[model samples]
Target: MKSKVKPLPAEQKEEIATSEPLPAYASEEGIDPELLETARVRLELLYGEVAADWPGFIARPGQYQMMQAALLTFLSAKAPEDADRSGRQLAQLEAGTGTGKTVAYCLAAIVASEILKKPVVVSTATVALQEQLFQKDLPRLAKIIPDLRFDILKGRARYVCQSRLEGVINDVAQDMLPGDMFQDAFIDTRRQQEVIPRDRGQAMRWFKSTEKKLNNGSWDGDVDSLAQTPDPQDWRQVQANAHACNGGRCEFFKSCAFFKARRQAAGATLQVANHALILATLQNESTLIDAGNTLFVFDEAHHLPSIAAEQFSYRARIGTSSKLLTSLRTVALRHGKTLPASTRPDPVAFAQLITGCTDKLSVLERFWIDAGLVSAEKDVHRFTQGEIPQDLIPECEELANLLGSVNRTVERIAEALMEQDESLSVSERDEQTRAGVELGVYVSRLGTLEKLMRSWATHDKIPWAKWLEWVEDAGGTNIDAWLCASPMTAAQVLSKNLWKTVSAAVCTSATLTACGSFDFFDRMSGMNRFPERRSLVVDSPFDYATQGELRIAPMKHSPKNSEFSGELCLKLPGLLLAHEHGQLVLFTSRKQMQACHAALPAALEKQVLMQGVLSRVELLKEHSRRVKQGERSIIFGLQSFGEGIDLPGELCEHVVIDKLPFTPPNSPVEEALSEWLGTQGRDPFLELSVPRTGMKLAQWAGRGVRTVTDRAVITICDTRLISMRYGQALLDGMPPFPVVRPRA
Candidate 1:
């Protein structure tokens, strides 16, 4: 079949082709005043149209302020002429709930993008928010701003590769077993893949139906667009992946769904993406969109630091690597057969390297288990101060060198197979494609292992947290050990990869500050390094003082006491009965929440819904349903439910917090950071734990009074709120709710 991909529109083509010079107003004052006036006029027009179209719309002063802040920050983007300059056009906005931040950023970003001839990329922390923007907000905005163009940016794995789909379909139709000589070599991860389907007929039917939908244009070829969710293992067989893609070389290149989406995003004035996708595409300039020239608006921006840290982390499993190396040896030899003798890769040379690495891995795994560093009782073993054992450093260096050589050899073979060729037959081309895809997997795996080994071999000034965690199967059988390494902080990573490149960026969230300050956030996010950046704090529309009250309950024991959970069991029932409406209980630990739930009376238990019992969406829906029917409903959730949840008006009339939400230095990264701070004579408790906990507490308290009409009570059972010195700081971070506490 011929490719039926359509070309970009004439204006979009022109927009990409043209390279207009920056406007003359590139100075400390910001953009040209006339261009700024034009944006202001458009915004006023939008507000007028919205007010006329919706009778219920009530404009708020805070929303207007937020809009203005966004407008100026975005308009302050550095021009292409100043791309090599040091200063950045950045803004950190802490817009309270109900500030309408989404509309504010969208309208301002669109105007700035047009004025600057740059794309606006809005990234959110959660899929729920991303969906809300794409499905509801942007579509509505497009109706008002007639010519607005936008697209959602998803990872390649979310789309189907037509070449892979066709190959699988042909293999099934021919009755060829999976993993046979003629089969495609692009295997999914061995951990989850069931290569051969148990029910082959059913699998074939689903694949054929999916292919039909793609052909008929009923579906956009997005996995999320399907009416029914396909089995994960089955979906992996045809999922588009970077390791297997051949760009324009494949016959399906023009009609490819993933590439088509990329093209649309390239032409779009606004693109909605998640934090993970935005960070992942930074290293590769041509992926989703160029970070260097685009204007970025990060919604829920507090998550960026942690998300960036996770993205830069590396992990590899011991047992999995061993099996992967064996497979790589076979794949390299097979793919190298078609290359010229002089240029062909030597399988024996790489095989020896792979063997040495595997042997060293086995030795290390045995040594750890024998030393009780990691066993059944203890799954994790973090190196103290991010330092590996001196005795094992030499072995790690040897393994690093071995893996590095193996990766280089595999990469050579893959490059040879993937090279463009117009003289080959159809079957020969298919074979070459399969060979390239298979070798590509080994190359990626070897690269990860090589990086991991190198990290473990040396200790740097900016330390990386190194650790080992054992993986267990369903039956509690030890399967493998994962060696992991991550940067202690994301500050340097963001400073180098993100903050320095983007034309301008606006990082906004409802809870960007802790204890009336952005100090904690600035240091963690690397924003403190830029002195010229601006910040603003916008108040919520809700009247917290009149609409809600903070209640510090009398407790027999502090939350740090072992008897706290028991006290919660005794006090919670009465609180639930007194409310006689929607209520939410936020707990810091799962074990404590479960214990409190088990102790509830039958009537109270029947009225309650726990977090793990149902999906978050379903749980919130059911809570809303019961509240609407005038029935009492309570939700028991952990820290996750503290934020990113909506329960306006009567849906949540009271919120009960079991204790202060303070996380210990549990993870390797946190441990290393805490240790380093302690050595520097800094109090980690005050510098790290308090600020983070204050942010979480504020989020939990904010859930109680969500609207101006809401009359709710926030109950904190922890005695620390009144007894500890840090209590005032935590209280200052929350909304200005009236206090109703027991007499001292």
Candidate 2:
């Protein structure tokens, strides 16, 4: 197959390769008034056409207003030559669910991009939403607009690297077994990967099948295009890694799956990708696509801060270190044996260096576990404040010093593998190229270990929280521990890296405000840092007070009381029988959800569908199965089911919340965030904890009234909502629902 669009011209390609200046762009104030008005009129027509094309499309004022706002924001940044240069054209919008936010943003963004001569980049928080835009929304827009071109882009790992595919295929031809190789395992300490497979044959078959599928055009080399989810172990081995890529130099470069997709993305007018991929590609300043001069729409935009923090975070795992050392030995011998006598690296010297690093890491790992700093939980141990206790600072300091020497040796060895030699043939270079890829893995690992030890040795490091968490598998004595450090807040990182660069951006969600203010989101997103920005809150068209009622069921004991579990267990059986249609019972913890399930009678248990017993898909399917066939179905779910779940109409009619959702006090990330806030002379509980709980409560309640016609009753078993003073604020902050508290 051939590409329909021509590749970018050489000069255009060069611009994409280079980084642009980040100095503030031309202001919207200088733009011609007539031009802005003209753009607005055209966008209005496009939105109207979308509404007219769809049957029974009852236009809501909120949806229409959101579209206009998006158009204005995009146009506000259009100062011709210097436009998109502080990229301050930003808006924090709170468009409620069912407001048709997808169409509003998509239609407005596409039209504005065309007028401004820039690509439109729409990022979703989840793959499901990404697919909806790529397959459903974009295709619909393309039909109406004719020339509108869009493509879906994902992280590199989501694609099968053709180079890796060819290597595995050739390995089979040589009768090589995969049980030994890791497909050039790219060790990323920040993200955990599955262990290697036991059977080489299974991996060989998967690669061959995938290659065949791509050739026949049955699959697009996209992991999502597969009929079934591939096993994590097999998928991790074959997935593409940027660190392992040789770019245009690889033997399989012409047919590379990842780059092929990147090329396609560069040609499109609008590129839809998940948040993680967009963040990474932009930060790396890669030439894969034109990132700047694009309008970015972050749907489910609330998750941006935390996800960005994860990207900047570093980690060092115990077992991964062992694997690193093992690979070091394996690669040294394999490459040394192939090279000519004069150019070969010394295998004995490299072996000793690898052994020394391994032994030193083992000693450090033992010291962390044995020290009293770690607090054991269900399966893991966490350091409370990310602090390496007072007594262990000396040991940690020594580890940091030792790691510096190890890092230097690893860098030297990796470089030696890629060094050009006069005696080397083309074939030797190919072997050297492969060896260099393996060397990159250890070199990356050594860097992470060094950073972890350096941070751990420091005391009273605010914002930068350092800790070690060790997890022991059930019934397995050998445990895996990780040394981790992360910023408590992603504000600084986002404001500097992302917000400063894009031409214009719209950060939006169904719930972005708390207690009738955008202050929480503004501070969290670092949008407050920008001098000129706007915020909007579009109330849901649904009349929450008329459509739903929140009933506070009085309990004899508070949720934290010793007898509360038994009391909840006793109260649920009768309450379960009272609700008709489908019921979604939300819980704060899995243990409580299970405990309440155990208290139910066998008949009620038979009627209930639990989250853990089946796949979330199967659980919903079974619940639907029971509900439609004239049987009652109730879904018992935890935090995951609280938000981003839709069971509209009769699928879900009643919502039962057992207790208020709050972050665990000792959780590493939250604790660090709290500590950081205190140092800044701010009340951590009010700023961080309260807003989070309110958002979650709003999410739980939002589940009940998905549409204007939706009518349901929400019962809160905990009496704290009305009893405690702070709880009243949470209740007041929730969407306006009529209260039915008899006596508190």
Clashes of 2: 3
Cα deviation in Å at residue 603, candidate 2?
Answer: 4.6
**Which pairs clash in model 2?**
24-86, 25-85, 25-86
TM-scores for every candidate against the unseen true structure:
0.89, 0.84
**What stretches of model 1 exceed 4 Å from their correct place?**
1-38, 79-88, 171-205, 284-286, 359-363, 366-372, 420-423, 472-479
The sequence of per-residue lDDT tens digits that candidate 1 reaches over residues 512-601 is 999889998998998888876777787688888789899998888997888888888899888888898899999999998999999999
- Distance from true location, Cα of 229 in model 2, Å: 1.9
> Any runs in candidate 2 off by more than 4 Å, and if so which?
1-31, 78-88, 172-198, 289-291, 318-372, 375-430, 443-447, 450-461, 471-480, 601-603, 679-681
Choose the strongest candidate by TM-score: 1
**Candidate 1 weakest lDDT stretch, 10 residues:** 179-188
lDDT, candidate 2, 66-85, per-residue tens = 77667767776533355344
Best by lDDT: 1
